[model samples]
Target: MPTPGGYALVHDRTIVAERRTCRFSWVLVDSGNNINILYRDTMTQLGIEATHLQPTRMLFHDIVSGLSCSPVDRIRLDVLLGTNDHFRRGPIWFEVVDLSSPYHVLLGRPALAKFMAVPHYAYLKMKLPGPKGLITVVGDYKKSLECAKAGSKMAESLVVTEERRQSTGS
Candidate 1:
């Protein structure tokens, strides 16, 4: 079983696309896993034009819950992480999806492979090999807990709103 604080690896990230930038405090830097994900609303906020983009059908499942989520459409975009000099990365392709996760983005195996990152969950640090040398990113445990709390509240509200709508037949 993972420690309670192991989830702190989820931290802030800056995503740039089409010369537009969006900073998200809830970006999950997963381990060596291929679960790259992007929030639909976040993509829109970043000014990533989706109308012209083709959507691909994909299925996602919640491993912990053993439940299948709705099949979501995937949209591709070129995105960059961090800034230019110090902790910069990408122009890499990302597949966008609509997921109500607390995270705005989930950096998975591909990203980990690209940066050759080593994640230390206990220390809440992610180390990567930069062009010049090694770069380290520290996660904020408090922020992760705060975001999780907020997400849970939002989810509860959504459920209540849905129940009300169904009861009213609107």
Candidate 2:
């Protein structure tokens, strides 16, 4: 069942992380990430101090487009992941990456392992160990489709731009 603080939309599943209400589609479970990733814009919005972050030579491979990405910096933040009094896991580490993505944040294997979350993609649901016992988060199939379409369009545009740049040799 969906908790009051975190609920599934008619079109998408959303979670309340800290004080931010985020789309589940925005957070993906990818072991490759190793650590959680927060988009530059999101970091700014969260008012996270980035000056002290240590620079790391980390490369991010986008599963959607097979493109390589690099992080601008890395920061350790107390990331609370949960809703209400049910459960909360956090103050976790996250890498700051400057990339144009449809999602604001991506929660990788580290966060998953921390939360012991088991995702069931077929049912668009994920169950995690919560303070109460077990909690489930449902996804929105339609919203996921929308995000994919947008991401695909963005990828095509980037490819076209790159091709034009190479042809023009500018």
What TM-scores do the predictions have?
Answer: 0.74, 0.76
User: Mind giving the per-residue lDDT tens digits that candidate 1 earns over 1-170?
Assistant: 23654555777787766647767778877775465777777787788776644566556665224445542555544444433577755644455765566778778777777767788888788888776677788787877777678777767776777678889999
Give me the overall lDDT of model 2. 0.63
- Evaluated at residue 161, the lDDT of candidate 2 is 83
**Candidate 1, residue 146: lDDT:** 72
Q: Where is model 1 more than 4 Å wrong at Cα?
A: 1-5, 75-84, 152-170
**What TM-score does prediction 2 earn?**
0.76
Local accuracy by lDDT, each model: 0.67, 0.63
Which pairs clash (backbone N, Cα, C closer than 3 Å) in model 2? Answer: 78-91, 79-91, 79-92
Give the C-alpha miss distance for residue 95 in model 1, angstroms.
Answer: 3.2
Error of 1 at 23 (Å): 2.1
lDDT digits (tens) for residues 1-170 of candidate 2: 33332322212223333435544345554444577887787776665566657788778675446567788888765544445566565555677888777766776777678778776655667678777888776666665666677778888898788779889999
